[model samples]
Target: MYRVQTSLTLLLSLATAIAGSVVHHDDSFQPDHILRVTAQNYTEACTTRYSVLVNGTSPGPELRLTEGQVSWIRVYNDMKDDNTTIHWHGLTAFTAPFSDGTPAASQWPIPAGHFFDYEVKPGIGTAGTYFYHSHVGFQAVTAKGPLIVDSNDDPPFGYHEERTIMLSDFFNETDKKIIDGLTSSPFKWSGETSAILVNGQSRQRTNSTGSCQLASICIEPGLSYRLRFIGATALSFLSLSIESHDLSIIEADGHYTKPLNTSFLQIGSGQRYSVLLKAKSEAVLKRAGKRQFYIQITTLERPKTLTNYAVLHYSSGTPADLTTVPLSPPLPTAKTVQGWLDHKLECLHPDHAFPTLNEVTRRIIIDVHQNVSDHVIWLQNGYDWVQSFPQSPYLVDIYTGRLDTGGLYQRAISQGHGFDNITRTFPARIGEVLEIVWQNRGTFTNGGLDVHPFHAHGRHFYDIGGGDGEYNATSNEERLKSSRPIQRDTSMLYRYREKTTPLAPSGWRAWRVRVTEAGVWMFHCHVLQHMVMGMQTVFIFGDRNDVMAQSDPVDAGYLTYGGSAYGNTTHSPVVRQYFD
Candidate 1:
């Protein structure tokens, strides 16, 4: 039997539908979290602002889960006014499953003073770096925290210790104020980040480092530590480094990758990595004459960059000042300077994964660019996504026989085939492999080539890599035969310095997804700023009739707000039983 193991979490018994397929760590799973969401006013970086904090704190609290068994997270929106919903960043459960938590697409925002329980099952393969965050508006900037899932078996790699590094960008203003400026009629852009933070604190800008508020981690002189780096920044792409040490990467987005050693690395929002760092020996420390090293972070590729620091402290034999700063190290070479996020990352455990990056049944091409219009708006295949909150959440509409196909159709262009949407949705039948291509045209207004970190809510794709030109399937056919690309929940679509029109791509990235889950899922740029201007869309697996016919009964809890009431439906996916 599944039981809750934590004060804030509880669990229910696994359903009978797919009982035997579940993976158990100790022959059972536990904990269904009740995360409380609230907006708290706090002072930071010499400014006062209110932020959407979970359980009354920024970056919230970490929730741990075991692989397999169904779990529940009852999100209580404790705020006096604002609505909120938490999206589990990465898990076995692709974002396609119900309660994956994207406001209006998967379901409605959990209303203020009310609560919603997200019931999901994390299957066998989902045992690595995942996080929870508010997906509504720009709330993720502050309302986010780590979500750890333990592997049933020992991890492929070994470490003496482990810790987390949450890298985030800070805005002094509130979420509403920032979003309003970007979405304004004349387009008042929200400027660069007020400050960059490592674990929610940073050093003060002064000649003296006496008042540094940086986060610190204590380490033994000679021990191997696994650092799980989370990219929680909303706007900036960043470079991270530590003084006199190397970071050997073991995992990316929850999958073990071939170890790639680097002095430093770049991280974009919504991305995650697990790196192994071996601490310096006592002899090396004695020669160097330092027990503290700074974990440095700086914004990448921007004219005016932001920077921050955290401390990697060596535990003293006795009580001592661990806060004493160490000498700074020289910056490492930016990998993008060579082009791409190190496609050298092949799957470390291919035998345990799906087949290598390969053949697909259909290709959907999406061109991204800022529109030439009276107001500032971004376009995906000439369609402007002007709605943030739909009257009917897509999943509810589909279940209640109120699914709207009005203005949704196949969009054929010179580039390729995709979907055109007023409601921003398209359907794909089960058992079909789909290739999604992102062609970044940037903007006609500015020559700025923005690197969009694209993220799909319900689907993790077989990544086909990215580069500074148009995607050519014809040329890459033979290349796929020998490569097993590492999977990514969030991957970057590049943009180059080259001159090109929206129809003429400056850069591109591609991914292959096999339709397995039946639900409405979100697809978009992980950069919240880009999504604010409509750089997003939706995907629905299985035809409407097939979905409605085989769907289980809907809970009365879901049908209350924006969720439509269905005459009859079940919570389980009876439709999936037909799969091989």
Candidate 2:
């Protein structure tokens, strides 16, 4: 037994070496580093309390690192309350297949007052905006925080200063309460959000005097500075603007884009964007050699639904006149608008440019449709995650085949057991152009309720045509011309905007895939709640027959296997706060 353990340890060491050189200067990350976090529980006092165990007064601290470096972080759950796991969102790496932190698929939860270590190499494939949060069910309220990476890649338009804004929504309810509301009650039917929070504070008074009670970060005018924005809302996309200045959009999801000079910027949950702002100064005051311009952050979205604000404050040396930058042209609406209709027309006419076969050699279509009853629930490819409701104490075994109500399990039951169908396995071939047709069919909008921010790890895709379920040629051409740079990991699939025929088939939203890299990747909605509802699927590149690809789901029976090839055990409906 001793010899076998020694051999395994040596093998893991070699693997670590081949992956990258890891450096740990902080003693907190040491193997012996252990810390306890506590979740504050409260009720409906306008400013409600949350049921999350956090490291400090706030959530967690900012983990700063340079490019081309690897980091190892160990989180010890000292809470006397629940199990947890931290998921490094937007970071691309490979460890234990299950430890990637998708509940039911990864390892089980981290028992209260336990320990887990994450081996992370930030900015490996790409550099820019990304974040880290909890992976347990419904605990994101306590575990989410910002994971910022600066490439030392400076901007062409220089700024005097820069700051990072880690924005998140806070809930006062406990995980158990939230889960109960989501699973057993009418909350799912109504499409209600818990509450909105900026940073960890509610929109209450900020200054010392009662008159100045508000969460306000004051700034001076006449300076060009950069603001890094990371959105961590469970729902709701952020529509942001400054009351007086123009915000120059420079980056999204941590990836750079051609600078977009605009007044209003829209950011979805789990998405990030950066902007440069040149604060305006009052001309008459400047003429008298006095600074006069300042700006206030404003929102277009309803304030009560989801709270959002900005960070980073600066002042310029010389007082000068101010001006608002012209609004950037709207993003190509082809994929977001006409993509479905174009594809339908192409399917009927068989055009050369719109070829039947994609440049991608492999393809998989995911149908995120609603299996609506009077109950008003949603499903991913016909499977409802209803079984995961109520946060049971004991770890439960979930048979994926038996998950869907009318799925392969029903066939097995009718055919006297062991009869499995409809769970087809598509083995991935190297260098194939992989395509996935994501269809939204059911009762709610897009045949499904709730807007989904579709995201895929490891690759970006081209937006194809889609309509309100009916394919049209004109719609296709319009969308095709509007294709923008491939989004790194996040995109939105909104329900039809028209009021008449509300549930019209919102056609299709297609993305092209180049499987240049080989690995097991996940595609899911960035909305934490939507993901918990089973809006997730995994794609395997390379041969599925490979030993690594053939393993069963992580958390098989829901306990630590002392770490598998997929790393540690994680909980289902991956939440973003337990890691805090």
Candidate 3:
């Protein structure tokens, strides 16, 4: 009996080794492309702005790749003084989390006049409209572009043509000035956006009279068009719509979803959506006698009511001339605007069922609030994130036993809320399912009810459920159960209502993620102002044994390259060429 059992075990081990060898020997992989992105100053958008241009363009160059194919991109920082890093915003680097492009967490920022090679191999299921942007400072507000991944197979739906619409809220003030005001005493928030842009162009209205030179899309009357909408704003939640059309949402943040039709879309910062818009029939356009329709974008936040407009022209023959197109209609009325708001009060993404969650192994509850000492600062679980140096990154510290586990706390004392506080990090293990509940606690001065878009690095999560009020396991049972929840990397946490007669519940958002990657990942508010004010935290996945076993040799090589200073021209050949 013992000899029979031993024979069976030996055969099983041999079969496993053969399977592993087959995977390792696969030779159908494509060669990597080295993308040289340069950061420089450019005069654009009716102002001489200090912008980060990728390959000399404000929107940079489009990076096209097939899904599941490994890519090697080398970004060269040519900015005279600023430091930067390019984050593959929606790609989950899987077991290779070090390439996630989060400064101070996975790796250090690429210094001026240096280069960093990012090796990204997005997992099998991630394919759709994703983008790349600077992860450090305010560079993302300017230096950004589309990173589209085509599926190995055709999409479930059909489209005749495609267009990429990158949305941003432009400000006349420089990034440095905006940071100074945000971090100053009495804490000044960015009041309102000076201009809103679609595809890097907008009509610069001068005294209510200006030529409409905004981005215009020429389309045939009866074709289906796929419009990829990316909200890369620094501080704006936009309500976007077309004059006479409905948007059929097919994908969100690189994940395919069930088709959902909506008249308007509420896009927060760092969010992306691919919607299909079928143009009006040729007969419909001929009868109307107009080939143009207005694409309106309005800010949902305060300072004042602001609106931007673009044109979508449909023609069966030659493209219509811009000068002949009629002016767009006036802005919607207050009542009409309120009706749109009412329609989206649920704050759910267009598709409510998809990418269901597994059984949760751990649960984390975080309280988000604002604190004022010398200046206003945003906090997560009573702690704010401070950027650490590149040489002593969060992952390296944790791996080398430099991090003190005893000092990690769930909440910070009000007296110890200053800059001297140690960094806060949460620990998890690989393969463990985690449920994070983000509860919005009202702010210090204001009613505390403000919308915040939460973004996570490395991987997407299932947005299981959310509701207005504090999260209670018992009272909020139904909201948590969903068979097909939307899977996304960025989600909006709406504000709680002020308690008038009866106490209102605080707003809460809950998401579930399985820890498949083995590195430090950052979760923070997508609003650049709020992120700089310290509303962020890191999740250190895997223990010492697990991390060491899954470590990537490629990450170590990049770390050594990133650590070499530019002044040491003799020692670093890459830096000497760029600097000289």
Q: Rate the local accuracy (lDDT) of all candidates.
A: 0.69, 0.48, 0.66
Model 3 ranges off by over 4 Å: 1-40, 207-212, 316-358, 389-391, 404-422, 480-483, 496-505, 552-561, 564-580
Which pairs of residues clash in candidate 1, taking residues 3 or more apart in a chain or in different chains? 10-32, 95-458, 96-458, 552-569, 552-570, 553-569, 553-570, 554-569
| Candidates ranked by TM-score | 1, 3, 2
Q: Residue-wise lDDT of candidate 2 within 451-524, one digit each (tens)?
A: 56677654455446444554444455465664433344566565554222333455455665654333445577
Which residue segments of model 1 deviate by more than 4 Å? Answer: 1-31, 92-97, 207-212, 317-329, 332-335, 351-358, 372-374, 386-389, 404-416, 498-503, 545-551, 562-580
TM-score for each model: 0.86, 0.69, 0.82
Sequence-dependent TM-score of model 1? 0.86
lDDT of 1 by residue, 1-580 (tens): 1111211111111111221221211213232676888887865554567888888766778888777655667677778888788889876343223568877776767766666556666668778887889888888988999888788888888899999888877887788888898888777777788777777765555415344366787789899999999998898888888878889988888888888887787787888999999999999999999887777787775657666667888888754343433343345433344244545778887643343334356777788877645567777877755335467678877766676442243332222354645455656655556778888885776544677788877768778767667888865555555666778888877676634544557888888776665667778887777788777788876545544444444444455572321111222211111111
- How does residue 208 of candidate 2 score in lDDT? 26
TM-score of 2: 0.69
**Model 1 lDDT, residue 232, Cα:** 89
**1 or 3, which is superior by lDDT?**
1
What are the per-residue Cα lDDT tens digits for candidate 3 across 1-580?
0001123433342233111010110123232554445654565555667666777776777888777766756677777777777888888644243567787887667777776656566667676888888888777778888888888888767999998998887777777778778789977776678777787766654424444466787788799999999998888888888888889888888877667788878888988988999999988988988788878888775547567777788865656453332344344622123212211222233543222333556567777887766798887776788564324677666556666433432222222321114556666655556778887877655544567889988668877656777777655455444245667888878764542122233678888776664567888898888888888877766555454445522223334435642212233322111000
Q: Using lDDT as the measure, what is the rank order of every candidate, best first?
A: 1, 3, 2
> Between prediction 2 and prediction 3, which has the larger lDDT?
3
Using TM-score as the measure, name the better of candidate 1 and candidate 3.
Answer: 1
Q: Return whichever of 1 and 2 wins on TM-score.
A: 1
Residue-level lDDT for 94 in candidate 3:
42
